[model samples]
Target chain A: MIIGKVSGAMHSTINHTFYDERKTLVVDKLNPDGSLTGDYLIAIDTVGAGAGETVLVIDEGNSARQIVKEDNAPIRSIIIGIIDEVYVKI
Target chain B: MIIGKVSGAMHSTINHTFYDERKTLVVDKLNPDGSLTGDYLIAIDTVGAGAGETVLVIDEGNSARQIVKEDNAPIRSIIIGIIDEVYVKI
Candidate 1:
């Protein structure tokens, strides 16, 4: 899981079936040191991650298909968890 | 899957539950036409994606368990597929 920040929210009212009842979000990837990397993505949010909160993002096709329980979702990235703390040795 | 670029690699010696025996890679988020978004992440590589290659990342938990066929893996982010093209009608 990658540490990231909720940059914004993406609200759409149409075609994507995967995001039909979900909230899409823009997450800015972050380094372990908390430096902003500027990379951003629109992800489907199941957790209540809000803007500015540090979160854990997941990206896998088969894994993703299993999470949302959809076989034809055009999804790759998802906001799975909110990070409270991270500790690294060395 | 979200469009992204593999920026670097992260190799570790122990302690993580999900990434054991997997090659971890750092991916940079990118826009279409790839202008470099600056966000980066360390993802478990199941595919043979190399550095500088644009790929797709999946982020979800229960789905992750279903994909790798593991129930106790603490994984949320995974390198699922490589993006070849994207056509948005915006």
Candidate 2:
């Protein structure tokens, strides 16, 4: 899992048959210093992460497949947890 | 996998024992219109992906373990493919 700040929510009407109830979000990755790095992604939101919230995103494809119970879900990233706090050595 | 645009790179000194030569990158998630969305990440680069290149990232834990031959690598994101183009309906 990596630390990220939710920038906004992505609204899409289209959905795959496997992931029908999931909502996608646009999130920006953060550096250790809490600065915006650059790697960004459209991740499936399951943990109710909203914009400006620090979240722990998991890109576990296999686990998502197992959770969704689909053999071949195209999911690569998902919001697993919302970070309450972070501690890193400078 | 979700489509994303590689906005920038992330450089980190700290690395686990399992991943030695891998370089970490900071990426920003993007909307389909190419606008900066909020989600971002620190991803392990394996496909020589650079800043400004739209890349495909895989968050496969079990498959990565099989590739790295380690039970626990603590890796969540890795660049699996680079996107040449994206086509989404309006």
Candidate 3:
């Protein structure tokens, strides 16, 4: 799991069948203390995460497919939860 | 899926059951033109890939596990094929 921020959304006319009714989000990777790393990935949004919201992203394909209930979907990254707070134990 | 080159190998004493007889490799990411991206990842190697060999990697956990014949392996990145050549049609 990774803590990331939703930067934007994406749209495509001819998308994979799995993404038919799902929203795609552009997520910028964040460090533990919430600093941008300049790395981003396209993820299918399961949680209703809006732009500027911190989210919990699962990059594992198996877990992601299981979450979406798709047996053989060409999908990987997925936003599983919207984060309210992040605690860094120091 | 990604194109990468094996940079090094890893050894762990206390290993996961699924990785008992598997070899872990450190791979550096490559662009379409074979340029180093300064990003790397750890992957379990299925093919007999040596260091400096460009390989095809499947980052999908389910597909990787299926290749290794493990139904519930906690793995994602896997080296599936060694690249002979990459023709970039640009």
**Who wins the lDDT comparison?**
3
The parts of candidate 1 lying over 4 Å away from their true place are B1-90
- State every prediction's TM-score relative to the real structure: 0.53, 0.51, 0.53
Ranking by lDDT: 3, 1, 2
Candidate 1: fraction of native contacts reproduced: 0.17
Which DockQ-derived CAPRI band holds candidate 1? Answer: incorrect
Candidate 2: tens digits of C-alpha lDDT, residues B1-90: 445567776555665655567677877765555766677777776667778977655556554444444567787666555655443321
Worst 10 residues of 2 chain B by lDDT: B81-90
DockQ of each: 0.11, 0.09, 0.06
Relative to the true structure, candidate 2 reaches a TM of 0.51
Per-residue accuracy of model 1 over A1-90 as CA lDDT, tens digit each: 677789888777876565677878889887855687667677777667888987767665554565677778787777666665444222
Q: Single out the weakest 10-residue window by summed lDDT for candidate 1 chain A.
A: A81-90
lDDT of model 1, residue B77: 63
B1-90, model 1: which lDDT tens digit per residue?
567788776543332334546666778778876776755566767778887778888756665466677864556667888877777665
The whole-model lDDT of each prediction reads 0.68, 0.64, 0.74
Residue B27 local lDDT, model 2: 70
Q: How close is candidate 1 to the true structure, as a TM-score?
A: 0.53
